[model samples]
Target: MSMKRPNVFRGYAALICAALLAPGSPAAAFDAPARIEQNLSLNAQCGLRAFVHNLNGGLASARVIPLVSGSSAQTQAAGGASYFNGATSNIFSAVTAANLQANCGLADVTNLVQQGAAGAYAAAASISLTFEATRTSNGDRYAYRAEISGAAATTVTVSQTLVNAAPTVTLGPPSGPNSSGDYTVVATLSENSSDFTAASLTLTNATATMSGSGSSYTIVLTPVTDGAVNASVQKGAFTDSGGLGNWFASNTLSFSNTVEKTQKVIAQFMQTRANQLISSQPDLTGFLSGSDTGALNMTVTEGGGAFGFASAPDKGNGVWARLSGSWSHESDRKTSYAFGVIGSHVNLSPDLLVGGMIEFDFLGQKEGATRVDGNGWLIGPYFVARSPAHPLFFEGRFLYGQTKNDISPLGTYSDSFETQRLLTQFKVTGEIAQGRTTWMPSLQLSYTTDTQRAYTDGLGNFIPEQGFELTQAELGLDVRHEVLLPRSRGRLELTGGLSFVGSSAKGSGYASLVVPEYAGGRGKVKAGANYTLPNGAVLVMDVYNDGIGAAGYESYGAQFGFNLMF
Candidate 1:
């Protein structure tokens, strides 16, 4: 040589070469040839030990050479690597690294080299490879990559956007040229109305065919049906303009066909009208009085038929004039007649009803040893109030009457007397059920006081004969049930009652007048049935028993009447 490097320089050179020859040094492998071309090759001067090292190095170098060669060959065979070309080579390299890390043994680094070579070769040949690698705390790194050629790997991402709020759907009136069999239904959307174009609108009890669409949709329904037409929309039936969001399932809607005004009025009237077939007694309290302008009723008792007529003429402004007359006869040769008139105003309030009655009655008895004739005039005022929110009802009444009686053969004496009577009653009733099958329970309390004054018949002069006075108090409980008949569209009514009566009579005249025995207690029971014809005529039959100790009163009766509506 001509020029020998310094000892220190030689030492540094040797150290650099040793570093370059170390295993897993990719940078040194790339730079080692430059040093050899400069004639500074360490192999030239190294001895046997160096020779052994070189041999190892050559083996190591040969390890990856076949992989590179195979990769090139596969790339060339696959039409110049059209699938995994240079652009995708990095993906293949990453997959190779991952495969090496997964399959290599820790004791043998050469195994990793071999595995890397095989993975690279496979990636190039198949044009596709996928691998995952994880890094460990020991400085081992793992990664994942996939290479696909001929068919590129495509990644698709799907997302959903929610609506800001639920949309409101309103149903417009039916679109019609007023035909019986054909009509169109219209629906308008509060927001994004145009979205309804693709909405699926379903109609129940009818067929819907889409006719047109816009902010509002028009659907043609054929054979326009009655009853209820239920319409609903399906979930996701409509998408916004951008196809991103959808409308909420709208609330169900319904439409009914138009009904004639007259029919509606008649139906309402019928519904409001009382079911007279269910009532066995007359409106004694006037609470159940009808609005009919005029009505005539005939009832047959155990003996004779009683005739009654009532008229309620409208006096304008919710006021009505009520006038009624009645006549009755009993099998025991007893006769009675009554005439009454009152004014009623119903529109005063919905929950309260008020009325007054002024009545005059005549009674004549000509049977056995008793001959009695009497005429009486009574004035009564009554009121009923019902709590709108409850099933409770309350009624109160006050009655005052004056009668003139002429009794012949009163024991052994004939007498004429004037009688004054005062009566007060209160009733409370409650409904247990509301419909065709209804149950009502009622409680009633009554107090009565009667005083009589004696008079002389011929001279019409007052006589102080110690006339009798009577006072009575009674309490009663009544239970009533009404059931509607399915076939006849009629109603069956059942009623039962129990009453306790207490009375006291004073004065010696009571025995002389042969007054009825005043009992300390009483019991009453009743049963009745009525049937109504389609023409609003009614037929009723009833029986009742009133018992006081061993003495009692019983009767069977029937009535026929028609309700008139104007």
Candidate 2:
């Protein structure tokens, strides 16, 4: 009788049948009974040997069997039953050995081996046994066995030794000082901790102490200096739980522990004059000064041992021009003079008035034997607004200027300076008669700054003089009463005002020697009159005295001007 071999057993049967049919003397001399016994023993021995060889080879190479999802028939046909459950290939195609070691547990591989063995022998009538062995520790030996049961029982066992695999190690996040100057560091492991110890860690440019035991460990590092701190795991100092030396490779971590610093300083000077057009105009009801017609006016002011002249021309359509020159002599016999021309234009609408001014000024001052000369140019934009239904008016101005100073005593020790000025003012007016008497109250604020520059002394040595700032505020009230001349068909206006002025100056370095410290409260009084000519011309005269006990010096000045209207 002949028995049919299962497809799973066909490959093994073919190998044994080829061996038996080969021209071999041992099997040729055997009788029927001897041949049958010899075949059984040979089959059992060959099967056991192949099983142990494949198992040890798979484990040694860390090969991953490809277990694809499919039907049982397809899996059995693809030879998957020989190794893993429904596995189509014994080659590791998708995952690496390290990946499997990290993600797939040992229990998973053990189950796969047991399932593969059962499927490989499922067709046997008698009890078919398969064995597998793995290394439980590094440098251990592999032991494999197989047993068969039937009319005759047979057993086979084999042993082989292998070296342990290397352990993989990774690092965790490092802690240290950030940008805020805090100093602390903690280094730890990110992976593979089986046999890690505190003594296995080392540091460079820092000192380290360890905490925790076994696989996980923390190292505290104290930096010798404030800079970059580096910590690393010492090579050859780490071993796996299986006593596999040099498992965890050395790794280094770096961090910073330092701080940065930065510093800055700024300075600014400004001068503002309302001009004759805005300051001297009478606040008469139904009176428009800069409309329809133009005028030319000249002014002369003398006070504080100084004299000055100003001429302004209105070109109609809210456009104006000014030429001014001033000379001043201080108590210390310091003399200074300045000349400038200003071109300005104003746009007056129902809601707001917008205007801008550009001026170039040249000034020179001489004190004792030292002389200083400078020229400055200023550009500024201003705005004014008044509510049509109210008597309140607001005005603001912002100006920027640059000046280059030349000193005769300092030789080459002169520099350029920048300045910024700001002015804001508000006025409230109440008119009694239609165009007769008016009472106006106003408040004004001013700010100025001058940049620092190198100054020279009489010995031609440079002085590190810093910049200075000056700020002033004033509040005033003015009353104007006009007398109508029936014969001349003109008006004579008389105006009087009282103002309180407060000012402060901040000086730096040698600035105190050149610029006076002016701070405190002061009182001012002004009287002015505008005479209307029979020919529609106006004559204006004003006188003012200020700094009543609250300034560096008292000043009294008078101004006279004539306006010819066309």
Candidate 3:
């Protein structure tokens, strides 16, 4: 491709020829083969442009030539200056092996002219370059000052940006192995987060309260539905200190919301089981205590539901000794087996009886991730007295004991503790007779205390069961009707009764769970029968409910036993 000469180039050539032929201004400027490439490239970026020139197939005697910057016509250089000279940014750097100064130090040129952008795209950059060619014949120099320019770039493009990595968080497991209806979940931040709280939880089937701060936070979950529980913190639900991350949601905390009481709740369960078995021991000596002077009785018993007992005692001076055994199960599936012996006495004159009993029990319980096994022995005294004038009977009993227990959690951690217990009970009753029926009314009060040594569990948690107390009261009545057997050889007595039992209590809980506070009452009904033979043989069968049982449930069962007296 070849470039067509512009009219400016032709006219400038003609003017140069006229100057050469003229007189006074001769040698003002000359013409030779000065090689120039026009509009080579618009290389202006962040303020630098470039130009190149040569003359007569060799390094040109080129220089950056200064012409009148703002002058229109006069005030310009003498004769040889070109029309394009006012495009200087006034800042320049020439690069070459040797730079040249021409026009008597008025201009300078090296191999290259470097120009740059003007004030924000004001105009393009131009440098007046005088390229001189040497004439082969006369060694005369011919030069021309022509403007060189570049297309100044108007804008710059960049690929760098400002952003931060997002933070992440995880919702830990429902706080520990929650066996109770209540539990908690901890949301832990991968990095510290300022806005993470219970409010950030996107809860399903539960309500919560929040605690802790920064990287670790806890939300105690109270299930609102008795179904499946689902909980999570949505992405962006919380933010970091730099207010950057929330790009990921915390892990989901999910479980069944149904009641699965364990740990301290199981303690209460097992405690109530122990209390029932200890307190509800049938008084096999009741019959002997009511006997006349010199009365002798022997008893045998079996098939006690919850706690069935067997006893046999030979009576002497109102004194008797007997042995009994019982086994019981709680609503929480905890079980207790016990055996005991009682030595009793009766004084018929004023109708008073005194006795003492010793017993030992083995217990096994499991709930959630905890299991406990233990054995204990207890000894206590009891009394029964009737005021001749008042026609009322009074009874009382107290027992104290300590247990050696082994505790295992999740089949992993293990430990042991000694637990002490004291049980006290008192009752009063009166009787009214009409025809073949007798009606008895009674009121009883009992209190129990358990001092379980504070211990560290397998996972380094403290069980502060130091001492838990429970008190209960019961008011009941029984009506018995006698039916004589044929030939007057035996008699059958049937009895029915109703009772109201109430209790109040408070204690420490297990691990992070609180020992629950208790204050409530329930109604109970019972029925029983006794068969008496002429030779002092008797049979007993009874079924009753007294509003107490494993982990807080309705407690009812039956007892079957027999006796012989002379």
Candidate 4:
């Protein structure tokens, strides 16, 4: 029974095969496309001729012939042309139509024609232009004039029809070709086509070399070697296995080859010590005042890389002095964000002082080969409290803060800025360091509404109503750090910062204090310095000339003070 079952399956399989093999069966009905090959050549004096053959099976001779017109042959023969070169006549390669199609293959040839090879004698062709020359021996010398012809060669045509997977030649469309955009074509030549070694795109203007994938090849035309070519035309030639020359020539002398524009990318960062670069003075000097606020620092940056960090500062305000130990981190060496805490005890009426701050900034990197460039933002919160016994030597209390920022892009004139805090306050009570102890200064400027919002409009142009308001102004300068022994724990420093109140200025409804004569003045000068101690602790000092003085005019003495960073 099993044997019988196997026989039945075999019979069914044979029936299916018979149906598929039948002449009219679907499988049998599909036929492969007919394969055809073509080769073409033209001469200046000689007309034009093309060879074609079928790849399936065809008999044809692939011989190079100097195409000639009946009229030209008769005219030349009558013009003293002799048969003296008959002895040197040599036949090269057997070429057929099939050979032509095979050479072109199924590939793109747009760049070849448009960027034709350099040199004067090299024959070049695209779908539009054709050039060739044939030399015949005349006694001891051979001479063959050039022939160049093109049908609407002034333009390039692009479309699905023009983009052939195989090389081809065609005249312009009925409407002519497009004067712009890139196009492609395929060309097939006999395996025995001429050699390109001696071929040239421009005799005196350009030169070229032969290159491609197959033994039979496609020609690429470029401008002259070590010379510039007009960026508007195509030139070059394709050499076959045989040593015959194909040439590309220009009829109007205005032809040129096209090249795509060049493009480059930019990535960088930058930072500089502006004061050091501009000032000639080696030492910073000024009176010390108020409580030490802190130090102002500048950092350099590097660009084109990512920066990551831990926690950042919240938006709030109050000032404190620098501590013995403070550490910071940076992305590409620029302080992207920072955090720390510290407290100190002074002998002044408002004695004990303590607080901490966390800061965040978004200054896009600086600009340079190694620098990052752009705008940035910074925000941090802080707290400070001091005793309240002395009026001339008293105490203060305050906290919280935030900072806003902006910058320009690489090489452009665009710029931006933002404010992160609306109110500022400082409250710290501690004994003055050294013999200057027993006295402390408190400066407080506080705001209640929209504390750390950024100024959105009129960036760079100051507008008061849109800015944060200041509540108070205090000025004080005193020496500290003398008790630390030989001033080693870094030099004692006096630091100060100002707070401007937002109010309608110039009697205008705009709430802004536009007067530079006040602490908000455009030209107020501020300065500070620091010294390092053997214990690695640092003492900092600062002074700000808030442009407002006790004389009811432009007061220029030190105003605020700080022992830490600003």
Candidate 5:
């Protein structure tokens, strides 16, 4: 289905948007005071009449003052006032007239109802400002100089909440040493007023030294080459940055001579334990029917950097093989591309933890077919949060894609068109320990489109074109725990998961057979075991059986995979 249409098939279009907009979503919302929409002419004149207003009770100054002249006036007025005191800032006839006559280069100030604000407001306010501006006597756009001079009658009433704030920061290591084997520094933060929120920080001649994260700074100092080093700190004032102050920890860097190396690789193989079926399951034949999917990777460390590459091969159904390549420089890594005949995956990132990814593939057409082919691109943004010491973990992914295809034989081929697709998942995992065993519980959601399209061979040599959409609303509960191992070098884990799949499919151009089957909703259960090899390599295997099958018989399969990182 096109993005322009509603989701009658799966009805997930709205659901996805709502999910993305949910709390703790990847990106932050826009918090600008006004979404200004006007020509530069009016925007320029707006500078003189700007004022601050406190809508959330008169506890603070809510806006920045913009004036052309009288820096003295501003300092004596808004500057001296406590920013948090709520006030109704009005800059109308007085300031407007004065600014026009003094700095606007206007010959006269009349019909001026200028009013503007810069702080957060309960609701937007409008001022009917109409002032007579002076132009060059030549009647042509010449720069003689037009200045509007006068003291604008401006009155600002501000109310602010007196919030008690304290200086808080993470302590970081020090850099320089003081006399008597001591080092000293200071941190200063300005008291913020009600007008705005601060979002930035800066340090002078000081370097930040911290290993972890949070609202703290580490102050580490290297001992003097001939002696020892001591350190002390003092607090300073906080000044405004270009915009809102950032509300997060800060890290600073000094000279460093540290180089690190890292590498990661994942490989999986689907083992066919029953009659290697083909006629019934088409999409599953390529990867699922294969006995093994293998991959290997390695990296070298140098000047604070590293790189690696790997390839996983699987031969099933009419599909062939896939290979992946990646590289890393410190914390940033990128995957150039992954190419394969049936299914190809590409990841461009420093680590698997998260970044951007795109996977493309050509499926459907038989191996020796002369023409027919189905190809599409799946691209999306992803993020993952994990910690070795934390019991709770989270992962999220979002993907939007479009697909197009061509028919092989003239009469047998279908028409061609574009189809859009979306995929998103959010999961949270918690780890529980029971003696020698640890269990991981997780919650997740999977969403997809439920519509598709295709054309027939009727329209004048016009090959039949078609598309289809499918969706699975799955709710799952899973547990994974570490098992007793023989040695400290090797590890083992046991896992089990249950899921309920609700599916739907629809289309116009393609036949019903091509459409995905929702069939009857069913419960699926799976249990698996994983073992760690000697050289930091991990091996995993799992078996799953779903009671109800959409195409034919109940579906059951086992998968094995391994991962190596250094």
Candidate 6:
């Protein structure tokens, strides 16, 4: 009896299904909506049916929406593209469809045939200049609005349709270690699609196996040997879900293929930021005027990189003595550090000091995994001149550097290379003293260069030598406010400055590697305070935020130091 009860229930359901499937209750009426009252949005290109369903839904009279010959209305979609590229425009003639067929996902955008329809047609009733649109993440969107009336003048509600636009392509590096290894290069679209597939993309110089959804796909490629891999999609790769807007060509991406090569590229990147490159001078900002005999400093920069400074100024003998040790922790597991020593001979006069300096610098970099480790040394001579006048000061320094490096990107392979660098720096300052405050107007210029050199990677990869160059000019004003200390007869100097910074990293570092270039023309601010004791000793603390100083890189730091005078 329990089994029979189940059969009875099933028989009752059959009766209900029969009635619903009968005559006027056909499922097509419900599936193909008779009328849509609300705004219609779909991830497909806007087209005719979308317009009919929204504007003419259940209406008797059909609206003739034709883009007249030579007539470009703001509301029409052409090539499945928006007239405004996602922007709104009030002007009617200001819009033109970009990609009529593909952008609107329409096969026959006859209505979009501007030349064919030129002066051929016009809307009899009301027309909509702006309605709905198709959009891509980085591409244009298209839309239009219209009205349809019944034969008996019955009104149909106005509505808009949203659809998909052909997407732009981007070929990006696979999951990290961005080096020689088995990894997938991904081809991503600016928007999702119904039919965009791995088969839709084309590759050059490499055979690829691809996988993923329509919006984005991943591919593994064969070899181009030492060359790069390219990826792009041609027009007509696939159609939008609307059965229109055939896909268009995509942007091509050239990739450093499964690089199976050596680590020469990595070595080039690590060589650019060597300490000898940017740390052009010591902390000259704080003690440019006074004859502070010797000083010691410790400071930390952005990215947790730190450095220490030491200087000795012999007023009686006249010499520019300075030393610095800098070190930086891992950024993506890559680390670098440098230590240097300087010695110079000088002639001292009543108001002028002329000298030449010799410096030896040792530095090393570890490129974690993709490449092994590297170390190098640099020796240089600098010609220096200075006028330490009371109200004004002028200084010039010219340096010639010779460098050699040992690179071992593999456990069993290593090579040696030599290169040279040049640096020229100049500064001038004028001081105005009034009451307890002094203002110093300063201007500085600096230029540095690294020569190109050729080397063998020992792995059969031979490439041309690349060089780097950097230039800077800064004009600023520094203000010093002195406070007389009680009982100790000591004085505290509060100092601050603002500078307009300019850069010159235009063609620096590995061009082939697509390394991001530094930025240009910005502002820098500096603030500091120093305390001078009656014993001719001073304590110094300072901070600087100089983005242009680092040339597109973040360079900000705080330092503390002590100086003694004879």
The weakest ten consecutive residues by lDDT in model 1 span 45-54
Prediction 1 TM-score vs. true: 0.40
Off by over 4 Å in 2: 1-295, 300-319, 329-349, 409-435, 455-460, 512-518
* TM-score ranking of the models: 3, 6, 2, 1, 5, 4
Identify the superior model by TM-score, candidate 4 or candidate 5. Answer: 5
lDDT of 3 by residue, 517-556 (tens): 7788888888999888777667788887765443467656
lDDT score for residue 491 of model 4: 48
The lDDT, on a scale of 0 to 1, for candidate 6 is 0.53
TM-scores across all candidates? 0.40, 0.42, 0.54, 0.22, 0.33, 0.50
For candidate 4, the TM-score is 0.22
Relative to the true structure, candidate 5 reaches a TM of 0.33
> Which window of 10 residues has the lowest lDDT sum in candidate 5?
260-269
**Preferred candidate (lDDT higher): 1 or 5:** 1
Show where candidate 1 strays beyond 4 Å. 1-295, 311-333, 337-341, 345-348, 353-355, 368-370, 405-417, 459-519, 548-566
Per-residue lDDT of model 5, residues 441-556, tens digit only: 55655555412333333233222333344444566677767766655778887888887776554433322322324345677899988777777676767778986544564766
Rank by lDDT, descending? Answer: 3, 6, 2, 1, 5, 4
Candidate 1, 104: how far from true, in Å? 99
lDDT of 2 by residue, 61-134 (tens): 11222233331111111112232321123442322223223332221112122222222322221222222223
For model 6, how does the per-residue alpha-carbon lDDT over 1-566 read when each residue is reduced to its tens digit? 98999999999999999988876521111122344322332224332322222222211111222333432212332222211211222232322444333444333222332211111012122223233344432223445443333322324344444454555566775442232333477877666666766677687766667778766777776655445667777766765545444445767766653222343444354445432555536434334456345655555555555455556655455455556666666565455555555655454544454555555655665555333333433444333334544576777667776776666554356666666777777887777889999898988888876654765556555634666667778889989998877776788999999988776563333432333455467888889999887886777889988765444466677877666654
Q: Please, what is the whole-model Cα lDDT of each candidate in the order they appear?
A: 0.43, 0.46, 0.55, 0.27, 0.37, 0.53
> How far does residue 492 in candidate 2 sit from its true spot (Å)?
2.1
On a 0 to 100 scale, what is the lDDT of residue 264 in model 1?
A: 23
Rate residue 521 of model 2 by lDDT: 84
